[model samples]
Target: MMLHAGSWRELDTELYSLTDNNTHVSIVVPYTAPDTVFEAVQSDSIRARVDLLLLETPNMWQLNDLSLACNFPLTMTECYPNGTVTALAVKVESVRNLNPKYLTLSDRSCKPVFSNDRFAFFSFNLNSCGTTRTFFDNVMVYENEIAMHHSMGKHQSRKGLINPDYRHTVSCYYLVNDTETMAFRTRPRNSDPKADPGVGQLVVQMRLAQEVSYDLFYQTEDYPVVKYLQQPLYFEVELMRSTDPRIALVLENCWATLHEDRTTLPSWDLIVDRCENLDDRYIVFYPVVADARVHIPAHVKRFSVKMFTFTTDETVLKEQIFVHCDADLCDTTKPDGICSGQCASPLRNAKPLKPTGSRRGIAADISQHRLSSGPIILSDSSNFV
Candidate 1:
């Protein structure tokens, strides 16, 4: 007899009764197994629910116990201005049976730079590793796709096929550094016997704080990454000079732009004329203070802004944002110091500083320069809460 469970079975029985000389056995079976069908449907629904849960919480799955043991953290070590090349480094686990012999950056083999019992390091040049370069407005971006190939010696066996390889990609942006040559003012046709003192060299550096405390920062990573509309970004801009103690750093204006060119259209003002932008309620300008451990000078300026992106009617440009600041070195000791401690608004008519030759004191000799920092990438909002 055929059973509803998709199997055939036979059963026999003997009657041992005086009244029952002959007996017959009858088997009954249902057309379908209702329990089995219900179980299959329930299992499919459970699988669908699990898939939906994974989709909703993607990061949770990444941190699950079944995740791979290795991690890949790619970082840009240095960017050569002259050659337009960038150096990148990556760290990976150094498991005994899962050790990788070498890494491939865009198909170019890169030997391990350093190795230890716990981790192995790999370094490569973006330009020489078959990297692809693209231009976004005035910014130049380089992308390198890297892969790790495990050592074939241990993986030669058929069981080795079970192990998985690792792959990751990172993009590096090229931006002008803080060091800039001073554009000295020209001597006037009619000037005093004492020639005008040339504006000395001034170096400006911008850094991003790693936490809300605004103390620890990613000083090495020139290209910092931030989350979208999740956390506030703290920035510290410092002016370095050794020529004169009377000189003070003044940030005239600061703004954010989608492109590398600060003059590009669709820019958002962070600080205008030494004052925070009134339109952005999330902007907070921290008082300038000295921190010797972080190399922050006593005349440093710091500010924090909530993460944001540039939007337009056509489309929302969320690739990368750059921060640019127009700063000047002012002689504070002068009687008529050009560095007005207040904002330049309609109510306050602050006179512009005259040319170095026209003004008598060094206060008028303003060394104005534009400093930039970024290619700051905003993480996808879906990645976070």
Candidate 2:
């Protein structure tokens, strides 16, 4: 058993292990240092909902019993059999002061020993072997309405990291109340009587980092897939939400290049006009086509759509979305395929075509192909219908 301040400690298991062999283990405190500072208050009684998960070992030749408690007269059950974890929400109220002699130990053969002087302590009910080591994680201690103490890991780095600007439009909606100002930071010590809102900040950072380097994003919550060369797609860039609806956002670099052509370095062009501006998030009714050049290709293509956003006169954000083009994922029937070069002929070469379908009076040159759909009328019913 280890004595951190004035109380004994027992640490087990490796939670947040950084390496495959749990060699690079580090612990990040959820909250700040205690208000009492480094003073060892043996009488600082606490009430905790301890969650002790005991992982089973492959060797089952011998079975041992392990138990854990903060107070001498621990409000917990004795050692349970092997291959099972213990979860107890003990209500350890104000107990008397404890010292080195107050240290609680097992009178049995395998006496508990102290390894480190961290916050919480751990015990094992296993036969000592090269791989048989106790692992404890998520040891949360609460008192009254505040989360008093939590367990930390071994050989932890005491380095301070700069808080990253995890301000993505998508995650910012849930992280910050106002995007333009980025206000309302979450605090764990608040008097809200709820779990730390600081977790939401981590969630926002994780989401931004995860999507930025891992997966692609799109304006629509649901991204579509198109059949390559057989279909056409209309992709766009839009804001998730806006703090001010009056401020205009100009989008640029609506460009794409096939995955296969990424190495060969294909030419890139704007998917939409540079002057197009978005006043609101819901201004998407007609989709903006991705074909920047008049001559588009027909092939099963996997490409990315990258865009830049400018608020007022300054560039604010730049993002990209990944997509694949194939017939299997085509969402529309009238997909403008790649440039065939045969249909570019002059319309004067064809004779004046007469309307033969139910819809008449629609005369056009056959060479200039187009598509239109409506309720068809009978030849004699045009007068009434």
Best by lDDT: 1
Candidate 2 deviant stretches above 4 angstroms: 1-228, 260-264, 272-385
**Local accuracy of candidate 2 as per-residue lDDT tens digits, 1-385:** 1112233233322422122344432322211112111212222233222222223355423232232333222322223335222111211222212111112222122222432222322243323211123223532211111112111123333232212221101000011132375568766875556664553110000011112222333232332322222112333222223232222222212322333222222222322222111221211223223253211122111222222211123332122223211111111232342211111112122221111112112121111111111111112222332
The weakest ten consecutive residues by lDDT in model 1 span 46-55
Tell me which residue pairs clash in candidate 1.
Answer: none
Residues 71-185 of candidate 1 have per-residue lDDT tens digits of: 2233334455554433333232222244334455665555556644323455556656677888877677887664655444553765543244455555667763345677777
Write down the lDDT that model 1 would get.
0.52
Candidate 1, residue 229: how far the Cα is off, in Å? 1.7
**Once model 2 is optimally superposed onto the true structure by TM-score, how far is the C-alpha of residue 67 displaced, in angstroms?**
68
Please identify model 1 stretches exceeding 4 Å from their true place: 1-200, 220-224, 241-244, 294-298, 308-317, 342-365
Best by TM-score: 1
* TM-scores for all predictions: 0.39, 0.16
The TM-score, computed over Cα atoms with residue i paired to residue i, of candidate 1 is 0.39
